[model samples]
Target: MAAWGSTLWLLLHWQVDLKSVLIYLAVLLMMHLYTGLFITAHDAMHGVVAPGNKKLNTFIGTVTAGLFAYNYYGRLYPKHHQHHRHVATDQDPDYHGGNFFLWFLSFARQYITVWQILLMAGTYHLLQHWFPLENIILFWMLPAVLATFQLFYFGTYLPHRGEHEPGNRHRSGTQRRNHVWAFLSCYFFGYHYEHHDKPYLPWWKLYQEKDRLLKENERV
Candidate 1:
């Protein structure tokens, strides 16, 4: 919440102009931060975030998720686990027969509803009086939208989309062999086979399993 609030402050107070190099740079930074918050909340959904302390973990999940545009963690907590259990099958909310755009839309449909959009719209109506619509779009709505796409592309589409490795139990895919490229793609979620295999690790710890993931893949 602190990260989001600080970003909001920047969007509202920082003078923004197309010509202002610094403001635009800050926008990019804010978008990245938004993505990070989303990822953190995702870790919480797996019960891997600050695990062993159920209240603290759920509290962190609820708060971080709410920061990501008031999402109800109660709704997401179950659905996300279902996604993992039913991945790549028609029952999976995140999969639409490997159709990229369709699955993306399906994924959105699973989480976003007409009422939620209306709520955000209504909230914007009230907030516009205080902050410019452009700033709200630039820092607030746009980043969340981009972060969703980034998440879908890296964490969903690339990993669980099509025909995965033939012997792989999870039917998941891994990204490029390069570590920097992997991390840059989606907080090391590019090592997705590792993730489905060990969803217990938080995003930051995903890299530590790289060597093991490769070794297992080679044997399979």
Candidate 2:
């Protein structure tokens, strides 16, 4: 959270050329951190953030979700559970398997609300008074939009894209054991089958679960 906030603050305040390669690096970093914000909220939804304290868990979820473009934790909680309950079906809000663009549209529509738009617009208007418009657009808005694509593609679309094997109860695909790429991509969420199989594991521990699963497969 501090990294995300501080990076955005510094980027927004810095007077640099938009065309600089540094700007591109900053955008990617911000996008990854923005994805982190959502992933943190996701952990909170599963009670991993504050396991014994529901109130604190919910508070963290609310703040993280809100920071990730004004998403409401109350609105997301039920829908996320529904996705787990009815994955890759018509009932799953996250599922729209045919075309990537079409599926992305459906997924976006589920979370994007009027209030979010209003809040973002209001924030943009207010921030422009102190920060450069280009900085706000590139550093703040563009990264968020890109982060959604990163989350949807690596986490959702790829994992649940095609038909599953008869024994694959979760109907999800796991990325190969490449922890570096996994974390860089979407906080190890690319290991989607492990995630579905053990939803309790936090993002940081996912790679450990991936290793365990690999050892089991080898022994079998």
Candidate 3:
């Protein structure tokens, strides 16, 4: 549904000249929708919108990712779950890297890769061309490929590490910075620690939960 809306908007504005610098900015803006879709699918996968219905959640997640040509829930959910249980501990695969400086320096080296993007794009194209619909290649597949690169850079790279609170008791500045990036790029995924603590909360409700939890903790 969201994808359809973005596609329509994109096509409606197709006559706009792509030669100017603003054209590049427009493309960048359109790509943000992909980030939103990814976060939506992530919340849906955790059954945050409707809990206890694993099949329904997985189905929705797969379809959402299919629209974007990426499947983090399918491929990365288990690892994410492990990260949740372990939190900021070294046992958390999501946070198992070196100190903040080293992690920040290796951000591009760690996650972004041309080969991974190409493989994802190629897989999407092959599936669209050989499977039921050829038009999907031009529509969803291509947009997804463009969006994936944006997702990699904005979603994964910057937020890999950072502290959220002062004194480094809970989240590092790097993680907090990541949260801000995720929030801007992917609709509030920057509140990642909150989400990890309560995966069953919807994206819209996450800030509320964080507020509630923080207040409760402060009282303690």
Candidate 4:
């Protein structure tokens, strides 16, 4: 949360300099941090953030999810569990075996509630009064939009797309072994089969799980 809040605060106050590469870099950084917000929420939903304290866990999840464009935790929690239960089947809220754009649309339709839109519109109006409009658009708004694509492409589409290994219970595929790239891409969520195999592990520990799985495969 500190990382996200600090980055956003810096960006919102930064002077506009479109010609500078630093501005672009900052936008990308904000985008990644925005992705972190959602991933943190995802972790909270899994009870990884504050195990043994259900209220604390739910509070953290609710806050992070709300930060990510006013998403409702109560709405997402059930759907996420449904995704786990139904997986790649038609019943899975996250699944779409067809085209990427089509699937993204389908996925967006499920979560993009009217309240979220109204809240965002209202927040945009309110923030613009306090922050530069361009900063609000470029840093705050743009990053959140980009972060959705990051989450969908690396975390959802790539991991669950197309055919899976025969008899794979998770119906998931992992990225090639490259922990650094995996982290940069989507917080190591591209090591996705490792995730479904061990949902209890937080995003930070996915690389360790990946390493263990790779070593196990090597010895086979």
Report the lDDT tens digits of candidate 1 across residue range 33-95.
777777878898888887898888888888887777677889988888887898778677777
Per-candidate TM equals 0.90, 0.98, 0.61, 0.98
- Model 3 root mean square deviation, Cα atoms: 6.1
What is the clash count for each candidate, in the order shown? 0, 0, 13, 0
Candidate 3 lDDT by residue in tens digits, 88-142: 5676554535764454445334434575577676866675544434234334454
* lDDT for 92 (candidate 3): 58
* Alpha-carbon RMSD of each model: 2.1, 0.8, 6.1, 0.8
Taken over the whole model, the C-alpha lDDT of each candidate is 0.80, 0.94, 0.56, 0.92
> Of the candidates shown, which would achieve the greatest lDDT relative to the real structure?
2
In model 1, residue pairs whose N, Cα or C atoms come closer than 3 Å (at least 3 residues apart or on different chains), thus clashing, are none
Q: Model 1, stretches more than 4 Å misplaced?
A: 215-220
lDDT of 2 by residue, 1-220 (tens): 8999999999998877857899899999999999999999999999999999999999999999999999999999999999999989999999997799999999999989999999999999999899999999989999999999999999999999989999998989999999999999999999999999999999999999999999998999
For model 3, the stretches where C-alpha displacement exceeds 4 angstroms are 3-9, 20-22, 88-91, 96-183, 213-220
